[model samples]
Target: MSIVSLSSGEPTCTTEDVKAIAGANGFTITPGSVDETAFLLFANAFDATCEAIENLPEYEDPRLKPVIVDGERQCHRPDAVENPLNAWAHKTTLTIPSAKGPLAGRTIAVKDNVSVAGLPLGLGCSPGLLKDGKHPISPIDAIVVQRILAAGGTIKGTATCENLSMFAVSYTSHSGVVHNAWQPGYATGGSSSGCAALVSIGDVEEARQSGKDTRDYPLGEGVDLAVGGDQGGSIRLPAAYSGIYGLKPTHGLIPYTGIAALNPLIDHTGPMTRTVEDAALMLGVMAGYDGIDPRMTPESPMPDKVPDYARDLQAWIAGKEKAGEWTADGAAKGLRIGILKEAFDVIGLDPAVADVVKAAAERFRSLGADVNEISIPLHKHGAAIWTIAARPMMPHFVAGNPPDLLSHTMPHLQPNKIGQDYFDTLAHRNPAAVNILMNAAHLQLKYGPALARKAHMHVWELRDAYDKALEECDVLLTPCNNTVAPKHPASTAKTEDNPDGCSERIMDLFEPAIGNTLNTCSFNVTGHPAMSMPVGWGKVKEGDGRLPIGMQVVAKRWDEASILKVAKSWEVGGRWTDSR
Candidate 1:
């Protein structure tokens, strides 16, 4: 029995076409052979099916439907004068005027890679990569954007991200370099660079005004909070470098629908804020299954069943106050803290940073928490496992063919095809992005899928290792960045001496980010919730000033509550900067 019937109207496939296809796949077709005839029929059926499907009306998720506003979507690109840090990709005001919820009166900045209907989503790449050299306007809001509006949060604009959201330093964004909130001509960390800058700039200004010993930097307007995306320390790195709080919640805890993804296995979007409470408040609204992102597993909570993180934290504090347990000396009472030994032992770790983070971790003991060092030997190899497991998927993802997990996909954002323009632009703007594409291809050609499969299997073992270690402690601690933010690398500009503007040597471009994510990326693959909270300050590697140092707090999967409680306790004990 024939699965697809031959019809007079079926598209005809020639013998040459069959031969070309076979030859592309390292095979040859014989004329008039049975195999050639079978290939012809298969080609015709494929063409017919593709045409039929293309003709069918496209399906859009009702949940992702754009929310109508009374007026046009007001937005504009800020000039360098108006945007000194180059933090904002586009500035706009978006909110439901009549809506009221936990985020009422809060102004938020969304990372540019996430969707914001009617605004151009740059993805931090050069304009050449986009269709017609212009960024695509998102037709629907991302899940996090929708939740922010529903919670009465007013979105101020889209923050800039690194090119293709690939780099850790701030200079790679196509728009321009995102300067640190504390200093100009220095990095803010990345790929969520702009989010960290927007959230921290206001606090930095306030500190300067209060007679604090800090350098003066002209910063434009900043938002109250920001929604930052993370894959291998994007959220936490920027937050740490910018002196803010960035949380990468457990995988599947928050829906990732309508957001641009590097790989579904590691994509996450969460809150970047100045205070722990704000992160908790934002998480309460954004964390829940949307029934659209396939990343949401059975472990994900239902919408109505999600925890009231803000309220619960307040209640916990209130209980402590009533019982005379809210004193600074006892805030962390009964909590257990473990400093991951390998995290501090990584190469390039600054002694100043290690001292700051270690001192901060020990402060929990003074607040009545039991703190100790625990060793996880596998932690040293976590980044390798994470890279191997996720690298093989990048080439396919960049080609707009992500894994078919039955999840809702944004076809408009997917590129039609990658060509020379993409490679040339990406190479000049961010050599790291080009390296990823080439590395994935090389790995596939050399070791095959088995290498990725083995890496994926090791992901489970890595998760188990963390889980076992976490059982002995409430939260694990580490230094988020090995040192304070480094200065931005020279921009790739066309010049007489440097004609192409980009360095031919990959090391010239890749050296700054060598160990940036060493301490933070492991938990991303393990699916453990981790946060970067500013704990102190450290001297910049090449500059004559200080930059913020953040300590990472990690908790077992789905146990964000513990992480929050621990952070809040440390925050209440005293100001982080005082540790300096």
Candidate 2:
């Protein structure tokens, strides 16, 4: 392409403008003929460069074109009756582009932040916070969405996420609170709340169809699988609480090109499914280098080279069976399992929940695996290091100006200039969003960049610590959440008597999620592959019935196969609910 010609208009800079610009940066321009003339010339060149850039055509990747039909774009905001759990952001069905791939006949839900052409990308924020009270309609498909269509998966709709995907609980989504699939009015851990609920509910329906007793499950319809984003436990937390499988794949294993990102360092998108086999099938199609996102590295397999995980898993089981090694009493004979000692010691951990996870971990011994407790002292500090290193860069991301790191940037999805209106709307729905903005700014002002730099260095150390631990064991096990899903708190909407929109204090809205991601977030920072597997059942703190308890399975970086194998062995042994 030929370069666009620069504008011939007169320079817009003035000596006064130059002085004002320099003054803002704690500097002054000398007011003399020679200095003034030189400064004006320099400023004009900069302006010309910017104008020339604007004149160039916007770049769009030819590989990621959307395939929307004329009438396929029609979508509606489902009513409460249509969406009992309030998990859907919009409901529509897109055409399946293929019919012979591995995911043939499967239904999939995409998270709200992922771009699906011609659909409203709500990002789970209130309409008032969006431009003109409307969410942006995506113009192109995300890389994952493209892969799903090619694999014969029908696009069901966009699933709701937490506000700005900042909270770990489901009640913060602007669509309305998402109730647990197992029990209404209780929490479904988020910000991948909708994906979790949909897949879990789908499992219940499937169980009923197979003549399995589902008298305890609520009535609902859901998709077979879902694509979920994870920054810090968003995907896994919900999976644990809802009795499903959610994987946070090793960083860059799946391209994040068309998804809304919080920070490039920790952003990941993976499968949320009701079965380990389904998770493997979805990952097989999704894992590969797209040549667009900077997050993918040399470690990422090319599209054609991606392993058929579902096939490989079955082959592994078959081989074990042929050798008479996959017996009922020794399904995991060759596996080495480690219980992360510090994961059970986090503050606010429920005694019953801990006991449930402990019992689940010990069950591995019955399968002939070597199960033992392993200690990684630095594990306890991983969350703090992750917070400091990543928080300083988040405000820039929230404002839609992420660092220009040569990735496929999504400028159209960036929000309008943030102001009081944005803050007020976000604070009422989810104070966590506002808190991130303020905390990032405060850290920047007080510590400058040194603190973040130091914390980032510690991130490497933390990774090394976990690496050392994994050297002694194939997989490390930890309780996914400190407790079973809690009851949903009241909304923060402003009321006549409570003008501030808070129950008693501003912190009340966030209190329920304290330390929720203690075990999961560390693996996110370390870039280790982790999966939340439903292990048993634990009682809710405030309720009488039981909720699913999940145990996190962590493997070395890019070793999702190990996670799948370990989870599958336990899965084949029997029902997790029976273990309780």
Alpha-carbon deviation at 523 in model 1, angstroms: 1.4
- For 410-472, candidate 2 gives per-residue lDDT tens digits of 756757678898776776668888988888888878998899999989999999999998999
lDDT of 1: 0.87
Report the C-alpha displacement of residue 524, candidate 2, in angstroms.
1.5
Each model's lDDT: 0.87, 0.86
Give the TM-scores of the predictions, in the order they appear: 0.96, 0.93
**Per-residue lDDT tens digits of candidate 1, residues 1-580?**
3636632384667788888888988889888999888888888877776777788876778889887653678799999788988899999988888888999999999999988898988999866776566788888899899899988999999999998899998878877778898887788999999999999987888888887855666799899999999999999999999999999999999999988888888999999998989999999999999988999999999989999998999999898788887777888888999999999889899999999999999989888898989999999999999899999887677776757688777777756467787787777668888889888988988998899899999999999999998999999999999888988766444368865455565565678888998988878788899999999988887857889999999999999999999999997678886666
Which residue runs does candidate 2 get wrong by more than 4 Å? Answer: 1-7, 14-20, 30-37, 68-71, 131-133, 206-219, 492-504
RMSD of each: 2.0, 3.0
Error of 1 at 162 (Å): 0.6
Q: Where does candidate 1 clash, by residue pair?
A: none
In model 1, where do residues sit more than 4 Å from their true spots? 1-12, 213-215, 492-505
